[model samples]
Target: MRILAISHLFPDLKEKRYGIFVARQLSEIHRLGAEISVIVPRVWCPGLLRHTERWKNYDHKCPLCRFEGIEAFSMPYLRLPGNFYNRWSGLAAFRAMKSKALELHKSRKFDVIYATDFFPDGDAAARLAKYLKLPAACLSIGVDVNITAHSSGIIYRHFIKTAKALDGTLACGQSVADRIKAVTGKSPLCVYGVLDLEEFSPAPDKIPARKELSLPPDKTIALYAGYLTKRKGVYELVEAIYRVQKKCQDLLLVMCGAGPEETALRRLIREKGMEHTVHMAGEIEPERMNKWMQASDLFVLASNTEGMPNVVMEAMACGLPVVATAVGGLPGAIGDCDGAILVQPENVDNLEKAIVKVINDNQLRADMRIAARKRAEEQFGVKRNAILILNYLRKIVEEKKAKQKG
Candidate 1:
């Protein structure tokens, strides 16, 4: 089957970790024998006054730049002035896809179109599918629905409309799927993000790995790897870590990832006198993430909201126990695995208690570590998820063909 994949958040040469999960999924789908072409629409700044120092920092090889096997396109806009408008600008992507689709259609027939959520990408894909009379599917991955809904009123509504318009929709977790249904009255298939089991497997030399990362030698390391934002419950994590430190002085919290909230989180750590206990290692590469996960004793996610977190799966794949808030599809992702501990959302006391348990009980920690890796391999392995997505796409394509024939 021929497929057109559109995604705004896809990783580029500059930042390979950005929206990498989407790219990985597409690559896996390609490996499953689908002839896939990726379309990434980017903005081109034309005005001089609008181009500020800030614009200089924007990655040039972003969505516009071509990857190994994917087709990319860009459209000109009024630089800085266009920033605000460009976000909700479905027209830019629509025009790009329209031009590319025409070219692709002449030589190749596409069975389906798959689009990732957030920005105007999904709407553009839906529009293109409608124009070409092809089935379209939209995939939602956490922040696409949650952050967008809270940030942009116009885009949020468009997201709901786009969700309804698509032939099928897929979400990372049940909570996200339910949110889509609640907003658009359309149920989306829940497809949790996957982990590469082979790559994320537990490292034999944990002490060496920890030393390589420059982590604490004596303390029991609790790692949090992801965006350092307020909504991620970073503040609550600090508070929980502080509480844990009071009882267990030998405990350490290692936070990895960078965001606008870094300064604020750092301030909190200092104010709470957690300087000795909490270590902030900002924005490590995706390749190095697994090493940190394997080196750490437990992975903690104190997010207020989430879909199925990719990091949690990765940590589990590395044979590290997970202690995350029970929100979104987290409970489902962890299942009944003793390797993972779930606490109430935004509950600092509960989070601290769970962390303390993991730190104190050596036998339980060992069991959880083993269980976490096994569960990840069984459920969230990349190969397994790839097959599920391929089968789903094939079914949709067949149904569309049958409908046309009838």
Candidate 2:
């Protein structure tokens, strides 16, 4: 059990599906044996802001990158760019990787110090675990704390003063562990992201996944995948797909990631004419998102907030049928789960009547596509959420060895 994960949220080798679920929860906590390393940071990107669009994927070659095979690093510091001084980008990414975190803590002698973003990756792993005394933890993953440190006030007082130098904290739902106990009263441990139900199952249907992802033949679609901003409710999902295309005119929605409000949501979808009912598609590739979730049928997330959203359990591990939006940790991850539905955030006629009742019911979309892949195989598996992050980072590394044996 040797970890040292600091974060700008994982993913490298050029944003390979950025933070691919924090690189599948540290490669399922290094296949349960543990031993992981990562550092990410990176925020310099100047030089005419390296050709806009968020610094054109901020120039890569970020010192020593390797994801799936763990051992990662990308440090690069200096702040005050966009995100107006992100409350001192985690102590300036822990003073630009404090001497490479003390030269990789004198050669991999780590026991703990993980984080996945809560002000510059949990404020640079709680200041590099207070100079390597070890034990520091975090996970939070829901808009860094329900909307970038609860929409700042000096980044919510430096997120309750660096989450009291964290010794443990984990979340992804339970509404981001009740917004980190309503802003740092701290009580994380939520557990909700990680899905590799064999790279999201359910195909062999939806007409061979829309004939191998060419999609749209005989529409009905509905997809949506993340970003395109407005807190991902994506302009109330293009105003409920322009009133469900004035009555499901062979409906279709599509969306899929890429942010900074994609040119003002494509100019409000061509001034509301919705150019044949919204279909952006943009950024795709987390291994082709399971053929756009088994070529879509139903899966929408008009999110105004969320802590539980790995594209709503990869659209319920590809069996589709979901609707989303009962804000963060999505009503305890798809409230009562029978093939998900939730809705409410920024309403839009209750997300256009649950996307026109799952696209005009056909036996309630085949019983919510078999209860949404049996609730992603009895709940978000991926080695049971990486053994709840390996027994909560091995009980905070045995509570710092009982505080160094009292």
Candidate 3:
């Protein structure tokens, strides 16, 4: 089957951290023998913020050669951030990608149009599919609905219309799906297992895995792969690390993301003389994630709110224990897993206690690692989830074909 997916959020070569989950899902769908073409947008950034990796566009090279098997393209567009964008963002995306999408459609007719987020991408997808005379579907993994659309009326208005227009929709977790249903009055398929089991499995050897990532084999690495902001409880995590390190000298916190609070974090690290203890591994590609996940003793995230985070699942798949805040879909995802520990968000003492507890127990860590890998495969492996996604896409295609015949 041929599928054309459009999104503004995705990882290109340089911007590996842009949307790692989006890349993983598309890659798996391609692996399942679907011919896929992807179109993404690169929005204008001010010169001041352009220096930051977060704001820099993943420069387009050869779109055809971007990934292993999929055809990828990047379109440029001007989008003023905030309220101004709600009305025109969808139209802007459709205009930027229209010509390229049409040209690609002629060469290989797409069975369906797929979108990642609802508002802008769904808006673009709904309009483009209508224009091209094709069926369209979309998937939202939480944030776009619960956070962005919830906060802004324009974004909410656009996605609500798109949601009503689309033939089908999928959501990562049920809480967000329910919210989407409430807002748009259209329920979505609640889907999970969005990571490749093979890519994220346990390392054959920890020393070699640590060596590959330049992580010290002697230390206990606690990997945190999310935004570096107070809202994410990064400050609480740092303080917890400091307190835990006095008792456990081998503990190392490797933060694998970037955010607004980075400058403050650096200052805090300096003030606490934790420059060596806390290593900042600015956002990295999902491809390199297996190495980071396997080399670490445990995965940690202290987010104030989240859906089922891709990181926790990836870490579990890599056979690592997890210590995370008991917020959002986390409680449902890993709260009961033997290798995982859930603590209250913004609680430094509790976070420290859990870290020290998990770090000190060698047998517990080893057992948890095994259980974590088993649970991940049984629950969240891509083999199960990707097939579900492919099947749903196939259903969309079949439905479209039937409609045409009728």
Q: What is the TM-score of each candidate against the true structure?
A: 0.88, 0.36, 0.88
Report the backbone clash tally of model 3.
0
Q: Which is better, 1 or 2, measured by lDDT?
A: 2
Model 2 C-alpha lDDT per residue in residues 1-406, reported as the tens digit of each score: 8888887865665556777888887888898888887878877776687787667667645543355648887778877655547788888889989798789889989888888868788888887888878889888777777777766587877887787678888888786787677766857777876888988988866777677877767998888887677877788878888998899899888888887888888887898778778888888878788888788888888878766778778888888899888887788877887787887899899889887988888898878889988888877878888887888888989978998899
lDDT of model 2 at position 320: 88
Query: How displaced is residue 136 in candidate 2, in Å?
Result: 23
Model 2 lDDT vs. the true structure?
Answer: 0.80
What C-alpha lDDT, on a 0 to 100 scale, does residue 158 get in candidate 1? 72
Worst 10-residue stretch by lDDT in candidate 3?
Answer: 56-65
lDDT of 1 at 367: 97
Instruction: State each model's CA lDDT, in order.
Output: 0.78, 0.80, 0.81
Q: Write the per-residue lDDT of candidate 1 for residues 151-261, one digit (tens) a residue.
A: 666666677777778778788877778888897776777786657788899988689888887776677889998888788999899989888888888888899998768
Q: Which ten residues in a row have the lowest lDDT in candidate 2?
A: 60-69
Give the least accurate 10-residue stretch of model 1, judged by summed lDDT: 74-83
lDDT of 2 at 216: 69
lDDT of 3 by residue, 217-309 (tens): 898899999877776888889999999989998889999988789888989999999988999998776678888888888998888777678
Model 2 misplaced regions, further than 4 Å = 4-20, 23-37, 41-43, 47-74, 77-102, 107-223, 228-261, 275-297, 300-309, 312-314, 317-358, 364-366, 382-406
Candidate 3, pairs of clashing residues: none
